[model samples]
Target: MPLYDYQCSRCGEFRAFRPMRDSQLPQACPECDVLCERTLSAPFLSGASDGCLSRPQGAAPGGSWRKMCGFGCSGAGCH
Candidate 1:
């Protein structure tokens, strides 16, 4: 299974992952109950033989953390 990041359309931020065949919907927001979006992401902690490095969310391509956590925009897009 791959680790993924998901943002709540209603709430804020959250992370999630499951079987590649599984659903990508959030049950509820840690802050509030709302839907979320799934974002395919890059490796957060590279357990490579070299060393481990933590990349910030929305970083570059390979070093980037996906933000499928719903629309980060405000206004009517709120779930």
Candidate 2:
């Protein structure tokens, strides 16, 4: 089952866990009992599945060691 994200118009932030089969159904707001529309959340990528961003490989600045140029957490905020 895929967990989906939903925002309550009455409340604030909330998430609804629904299977892909029932993804199209309307849901009742847990706060005001009104029908709240489901919003699409950003896709979560992890590890190697993150495509090109998986590694922060880039060129090194002039005067820097070549070893420091390869894949590393130089300034891409890997940490």
Candidate 3:
């Protein structure tokens, strides 16, 4: 399985794990149950390369938390 990124019109962006055979199918928004469109995103590269670390979803530029919930929330804390 591979992780794919999708963007919902009402709820924003989210990630889905699906089989390669079904990769072209739209994903249902976990929040609003709407069908989300897939986003063209950069491929994730693991390990330190050129002395730089890979940033995760909620990581801020200054090494502080960006307060993202990784679930298309407004960062005020998702329910």
Best by TM-score: 3
Ranking of models by TM-score: 3, 2, 1
Question: 11 in model 3: Cα distance from truth in Å?
Answer: 0.5
| Candidate closest to the true structure, highest lDDT | 3
Task: List per-prediction Cα lDDT, in the order shown.
Answer: 0.42, 0.45, 0.55
Model 2 agreement with the true structure over 2-65: per-residue lDDT tens digits:
5454555555444455688888776665445666667766753333321222122343222122
What is the Å distance of residue 31 in model 3 from its true position?
0.4
lDDT of 3 by residue, 44-75 (tens): 44332231111244444322112344223334
Error of 1 at 66 (Å): 11
* lDDT per residue as tens, model 1, 11-31: 444555456666455434434
TM-score of 3: 0.58
lDDT of model 2 at residue 73? Answer: 24
By summed lDDT, the worst window of 10 consecutive residues in model 1 runs over: 69-78
Q: lDDT score, residue 18, model 2? A: 68
- Using lDDT, rank the candidates from best to worst: 3, 2, 1
For candidate 2, the 10 contiguous residues with the lowest summed lDDT are 61-70
Q: List per-candidate RMSD values in Å.
A: 11.7, 14.7, 9.6
